[model samples]
Target: MPYTGPQSVDRALEMLDAVADAGGPVSAKALARRLECSLSTAYHLLAPLTERGYLVRTAQGYALGPRIPGLQRSLMQHLEPVPRMADVLAGLRRATGAEAYYTAYRGGLITVVDTTAPVTDTGNPFTPGRETRAHATAHGKALLAELPRPVLRRYLAEHGMPRLTRATITCAEVLEAELSRVRGQGFAVSVGEVDPAYTCLAVALPRGREGGRGRDGGAVHALSVSLPTGEFRRRPQEIRAALAQAAAGCG
Candidate 1:
């Protein structure tokens, strides 16, 4: 929780950062190399966080714990951009009668900064501070598409695509093909990939006024709209249009 001045803790933080930058789960060995620490030392550093639930060990490997995203969201809630994004999402909800979410990508993972759900809808299952799936989500695909080709290719190679739902992209080849389409189209959409009943559409975040350090370092944000199945099927193009308009508003 609180960071006392311990070298081990510092190393642990470095390891966590490595995993986050990886954009997917990372192995202890990979994290150790990234942190430049011994394997034992890396596991030691990861232990406390895993126990506390800031990291999760899944069949795929180590992913960021759900709590970590929540913490980041809380910290970002104070920023001006997030509030503005919240306002945008609120308007999107009103306009489309659906759930809207704003996501920001800095190092590796794309995290939700805020969200708004229509009063009538049940709301998106994920929210501010939740970790959005990179493969199964429109925002995830959009973010990956935003990355430079070489960088994105390496990432996909290291983290093989896994099936989330029956609709989830199961092969790297297919996913990359779809990412190529997203790159050309300048946005990404999901049809029951994340959840059988949910549809999501996301657009690349408008590039902020220059001067920022990052990987792609171009787009710092993304706009996503998630809604129930039937409505999305009925008005797919309309929802995509709204998402694009919302992103276009960013200065």
Candidate 2:
């Protein structure tokens, strides 16, 4: 080849692979050692991934971000699900006639991995790569449904309850009750908690070969379907069922 590659790029890829293979986040010093480079160089490589939403920082270390699954969701959205999942969401949309989205938990928050809105829809201008409040989102609740009791308790204690709406579950006692129901149902339903006019339903997806949220916050992903409160009121179960199928096909 007339031109060669950037040696820095190659080394950075090596570092990412190492951190991914570790199944959890790694520290800057540890990653530098693995790549036989300086901490500064390792951080430089990590910067792009972080910007691209591929990695997130955790208290213990750096791990994959929630956006990786979003990429997977994009690839699979047009293809078949698992056996190449095709068209279930289309039917779901037609059935409800509103906007829908799929989300997953990452970095102690919910990230919109993928979204689809109706051709005739009138909605907000939010795009992907946005980290939303886990407490106020159905996707977050679904992931929270799987949280160990002690972990959830501690998290609530640390983050404190912030109310986004009158319907938002801000009290610890009330949230505990809601989480209990979510755990039992294996899904979550949020009514005007995130946005006053919108409601969302979510279910946690099983981890793929690579488990955990991106090389950061150590939470699993969930599939979320959101619609206007008016539409959601009419077709809640339909949304939940379709999302369950989508989550199954995520692998």
Candidate 3:
């Protein structure tokens, strides 16, 4: 069966994602398969967007159009300021002596909002951006563990747990159990789940005051530190104490 809610709009968005994922203009047939729709449906979905300049059709196929730049600019203008999370990220870095990060969960995406000033000083593994595998990182798990049960379930349904390493929790049931433990412990830990040589610990930060208006506008954020696996294991107590103190001041 085809999508029922705002059928054309949903189909168009799916088509857009398919084209973008293809990394170039894609044939209507390939897009149909990617969208799990018929060739005719794919054309029908793309036609209006193409005409309206949301998409561009070339001899090869369709790509994002010029209008996208304007739209992106408009989006940036409406985004919340970045300053709100800067001070907190700086404080976390000083307290932990490790790469400190502030990540926000919103619209079913985990985005790194701010990182400490010296992100590369101690050889951090990750850069600030949207994370690919939420189930394999301490900060991702911390944010996931804080979500209400229903929302958590919805997120899992939309984005299944994908394995990133031998230690990643690929099963939903197991992940739920792990999140339960995270809740009880008041923090989340990832040991070689994201990187074979790294360990990370994270604690969920409360939404900001003033209705959570910074870095993606009310997106829930977490504080985290990454370390070499050996160092993390050796100084677990000390690192946890620093993380706890930093997390306490997030709001």
Give the clash total for candidate 3.
Answer: 0
The regions of model 1 sitting more than 4 angstroms off are 1-83, 118-123, 130-132, 157-159, 209-219
**Candidate-wise lDDT, in order:** 0.73, 0.66, 0.76
Q: Which digits, one per residue and each the tens of the lDDT, describe model 3 over residues 136-190?
A: 8999899888776777777788887877789988988888899999989999999
What would the C-alpha RMSD of candidate 3 be, to one decimal place? 6.6
Question: Worst lDDT window (10 residues) for model 3?
Answer: 208-217
- Candidate 3: Cα lDDT at 196: 85
- Each prediction's TM-score versus the true structure: 0.64, 0.55, 0.63
Cand. 2 TM to true fold: 0.55
Model 3 misplacement above 4 A: 1-84, 117-123, 208-218
Model 1 global lDDT (CA atoms, 0 to 1):
0.73
Total clashing pairs for each candidate:
0, 15, 0
What is the C-alpha lDDT profile of model 2 across 1-251, one tens digit per residue? Answer: 11125876677667667877775679988997887777777788888877887888888788888887887767444322223222544554565565555554443444565556633343553234455467777877777677666667766776667888888888877888898898898888888986899888877766631333232235365666777888777867776667676666665
Measured over all alpha carbons after superposition, the RMSD of each candidate to the real structure, in angstroms, is 9.7, 12.1, 6.6
Better of 2 and 3 by lDDT: 3
Ranking by lDDT: 3, 1, 2
Better of 1 and 2 by lDDT: 1
